[model samples]
Target chain A: MSPAQHEPDEDPGAPASSHAVSAPGAPSAARPKVPRRVAWRRLSTISRARLSRGTLLAALLTLVLGLALVAQVRSTQTADLENLRETDLIALLDDVTDRADRLEDEVRSLEQDRSRLESGGGDAAAAQAAQSRLESYQILAGTVPVSGPGVSVRVSDPEGEVTTTMMIDLVQELRDAGAEAIQIGPARVVATTWIGVDEGRLTVDGQPVAAPYSVVAIGDGHTLAGALAIPGGFNDSVRRVGGEVQVTEGEELVIDAVHEPPTLEHARPVPPSEGR
Target chain B: MIPVLGLVVGVVLGLMLQPEVPGWLEPYLPIAVIAALDAVFGGVRASLEGIFNDRVFVISILSNVLVAGLIVFLGNQLGVGAQLSTGVVVVLGLRIFSNVAAIRRHLLGA
Candidate 1:
């Protein structure tokens, strides 16, 4: 027994090796109140203190643990899917299958629409399916001027009291009343159209148009005019701003403004399939 | 602490090598690592209790890893590889948590 290790405090927890004790059962029965510092000292001084078989094997095993630990950590944390349970993987596969089935159903319906339109297009119906697709595209793309039975709205605001809200409300009401094609102050109101205020001027798609704002919407003229003149509706909101609301129902309203088709750097029409 | 240093050296060696695990070893590697962890926790607890036995530690570590890998391999043969792998991990994970808890109390005297 070394006199230094018998100082009671250091010896109590320094039994990392069997050689540190006279009897194997003696150390466990001794004082168990020592700090972890003694154990730390016992382990830290392993090369100088003692090299028992248990300590040696423990060291070797710890080294293996380290290698395995890092390897396992990297594997689990990486994009590898090895850690997932079979049930979890099955569930994921099932979810994907469900999504694919839903997409197939949607494709089938779209294919049905195409077949109806493409009774005989000399090409597959993918790119051309729905009835009135050409007219719809022209109207939505704003590539061609449109005309039909519709209503014309002219609001003259001498005081310039008309705000952007009134302008948007006017267009929204026309849309709700089934206006198929709408033109507000030389700008065709397509899907990408925006109504906002810039420098205290009402802007349609970033282009400012001064009052009196003339809006022509091609749709059912009777329905558009009636929707605008509804009590306390768009007609009242314009008059509330001290602007004159003049709505005229025409059998045919012409909207000559055409928007330049957007140039495509990425998207291109997929070519039609033969003998769909 | 010196044993911990051994582990650190082992970690550095592993990182430097970064050897790709063989395809057959891929499934078993993670299982073996976790099983080895259980053995490590038991060893640390035994060391603190002055009951660490090198022979027992070595046997337990080897058996744990082998048995875990075997279970996964058998499951794959039976068309339930994923399920059996889950079973091994759950059992080993439970054992590891309990051993770690013991080690914590032993060191902290809590």
Candidate 2:
């Protein structure tokens, strides 16, 4: 490598003359004018490239690694399980336990009913009537799982702007559309059901519900869906509050939620003849 | 120069596409990325030392990712996945630091 080819002020301690040997041209006034340092940096990078093809290969590999790093970081950060704190873990465990208990109780009661029906110890007609009455009571009490043709409504508040009033209005609209049985998330909506905001989160019967909230109502699917899509109905209200409502009509919608039956403390059934 | 351009393009593509890594591969991705980073830093250091070899760099990159993943997989099979993952990360992290230090000294003359 010639002395003139190398910049006099380039790093004297640079390990090798490979850069000078591979430099495209010595700095000259006639050449396209760039600052000496910039030219030196560019030439050095080019010279490094000329030394071996490995530098380019390494760059490509680094590029891929960079992309993977960014993607992995994002995925890891967004992972819900990974971000769970101790309280969140405990809450998840509680939820699982509650669900398991509910299912077990349901199975046990259903097995008992089947055994009673198969034994045939009672009068068939009277037993049938009693069974039908029990089912009606269970449905009214919201203590029995119900499934039939209905509409499923999903509400999402992406901006956290949905208020309690909007949800109340939604429920009222569903009832007006003749919703026989309704469920919001895991809570069954009944006469005693309470919906409110607790600490900025929507809660049903004191249990926090997360978005997007799925509401399943057993009723006339077309009527229920139409009710939500009316000119200034639930859908419009959701939009006005920076939320979204998606209503889907389906032939079979299952709402397998059972609420605790309310106990009557003061009120009693009046004698048949004395009823006002 | 071409490699740098490729790198920029790769980043843009990654951002635009946002490809999902499979759930099964998620566990190994972080380790693989760290191992690849170690190889990249080592390559930079070697280049500054005038001993950069493309074949060696490529081989190291492949081996690093494979070996890191293998260690984690084996650890999972043996019921010690978390411990072994930590071990792999610590070792690779040290190597990355040393290589980065070398590169800094070479570039900054400090």
Candidate 3:
């Protein structure tokens, strides 16, 4: 190709002239060329168009929904905490009710025993046996002081994500392990007692188990520990889901005194031989 | 917006009416209705697309019902039935997210 044909299109002065003028004045002159408002408007329109109405609505809805979800979760947690509190109180009330009924029964039984003792009747031996049984029950209730070297076990459900059933299973296992005396959240260990869940929350006795369920029992520490660590023990299951089971040996684990059980004074007194 | 509004209204109405209704049927019907509607709409669309497997639908339906049932049952058993219901509500809140996401994807192709 001819040099003229290849290069003839260039305006030799065009580059220099535009460069000199545009370099110094270009920025200042162009400053107002596209106003800030116009640029912003263009950008806003582009973004608005790119983000469709449906998507925006969906996003906004999702945001509101997410907030609601968070609120719901928080409220749930709070309610669970409150329920935990109430469960303890209910357990306490139940214990008290049971105690009152038991005391009435015991007083009546004692009156019968007193009459039999005074009568110097053949049922005297039988009356003594009844009295012994009553004593044991009273000890079990913590109304009478019974002391021995035993371990205390505490089993508590964790603060978050622990179920009531799991706590009950643990308590049962402990009792099976020969825990002489056990205290769950607030419920004292007793023959008629069963671990109960209240409001998605579990309580022992009459106390709320704040997370990390505290299962306190009085028994042989070694035996209790072994029982809890067995294959089907509370320890194994608790460990499966990152829970804690602690055992401590002590010289004394004084269960605060509980009330006496009731007896039916109206129950017929059997003959000594028959009672034996 | 419309769906959210509908949900809010429905929830409020159900909550207000709950106390006035008979004890036995009052608690279950509202939740069951919502779940049913969700399943019906979801199933119709998925089935038309040949993606509605019986197993998936059954499992989802059973799980949803079980959760609702357990919340009520546990709450009653524990004497904290209301609190457990709160947990159920949290799960429902999550379902709302998934539902909204599905709707958005279907309508906007995004």
Write the residue-wise lDDT of candidate 3 on A1-276 in tens digits: 222233221111111111111211123231113333443443344234334453344334333333333333344454433334456768988999999999999999999999978777677787899999998767676565455656666544463555666777766776777777766544566765655556666655544556655556677767777777788667777767666667677777666535345575776889999989
Q: Which ten residues in a row are the worst by lDDT in model 3 chain A?
A: A12-21
- Best candidate (score: TM-score): 2
Candidate 3 lDDT at A115 equals 93
| Candidate 1 C-alpha lDDT tens digits along A115-189 | 976775754564456646877988878889988899999999988888888788888999999998999998999
Instruction: Please state the error at residue B108 of candidate 2 in Å.
Output: 2.8
- State in Å the error of residue A159, model 1: 90
Interface RMSD of each: 8.1, 9.7, 21.9
lDDT string, candidate 2, A194-222, tens digits: 88999999988877888999999999999
User: Residue B74's C-alpha lDDT in candidate 1?
Assistant: 93
State the C-alpha lDDT per candidate: 0.73, 0.74, 0.51
Q: If ranked by TM-score, best first, what sequence of candidates would result?
A: 2, 1, 3
lDDT of 1 by residue, B1-110 (tens): 44556678879978987655666788788888888777776666555655555667776777778888899899889989877888778766655665555455555644
Q: List residue ranges in candidate 2 displaced over 4 A.
A: A1-43, A46-56, A81-98, A106-276, B1-5
Please tell me which model should have the higher DockQ, number 1 or number 2: 1
Predictions: Cα RMSD each: 23.9, 34.3, 39.7
Clashing pairs in 2: A54-B54
i-RMS of candidate 1: 8.1
